[model samples]
Target: MSYPHHLGMTVLEAGPERTRVSLTVTPSGLNMHGSAHGGLIFSLADEAFALISNATAQAVAVETHLSFFRAARDGDQLVAVATPERVGRTLATYRVEVRRGAGGEVIALFLGTVSRREKPA
Candidate 1:
């Protein structure tokens, strides 16, 4: 978890099966269009996914699918919430929504699945 970029993300909540993180869009997170870049949005979702998916067990991301609903600009505070769709012994799915903190409009939707792995023997 040495990703320096994530150091800027603030953890709002961390529960056993759910989590929330927030961040304000900055210059480095913007694209040529002056809007938040897709990668940064995706990272916001991914961070939530990582927190919720591994809340109770060891898991690794197997697949992730995301859809952008709206564009967010610099200085916009964004919050991401991750909820579990299913939690099984060997598999899990989470739904992450990135929304503008001020208006609560979703800017990105992310669905991620993970494979739970047992401890090595």
Candidate 2:
């Protein structure tokens, strides 16, 4: 639940292997240039990744790489959908696509990995 609830993030779907999250760009979510902040976009994708990655056990982020295709502006609804690409013994990889609402164009792409933690002694 690391979503920016104060920013009005919406959880469209949450399941074992995939999750969908959304948010509308606003003044607070903007950068100096008046567009949605890149970090904010990344956070949206990361939230989706977090939901799908930690479904089984305690998992923490390993690494992430993101590429922005377009910038979303105020009033634009951004949707992030995360799906598992690989699940290994200890590490898992996921892909998150951030777009402008359903049927909208792709805006950002994110790939992240997380590692499961062992039980405490």
In lDDT terms, which candidate is top?
A: 2
User: Which tens-of-lDDT digit does each residue in 64-90 have in candidate 2?
Assistant: 999999989999999999998988879
Which pairs in model 2 have colliding backbones?
Answer: none
Best by TM-score: 2
Listed in order, each prediction's TM-score against the native is 0.90, 0.91
lDDT of 1 by residue, 41-96 (tens): 88888898998887777889999999999999989999989999998889999999
- Model 2 earns a TM-score of 0.91
**Global CA lDDT computed for model 1:** 0.87
In model 2, how large is the Cα lDDT of residue 107? 97
What is candidate 1's CA lDDT for residue 57?
79
* Model 2, residue 25: C-alpha shift (Å): 0.5
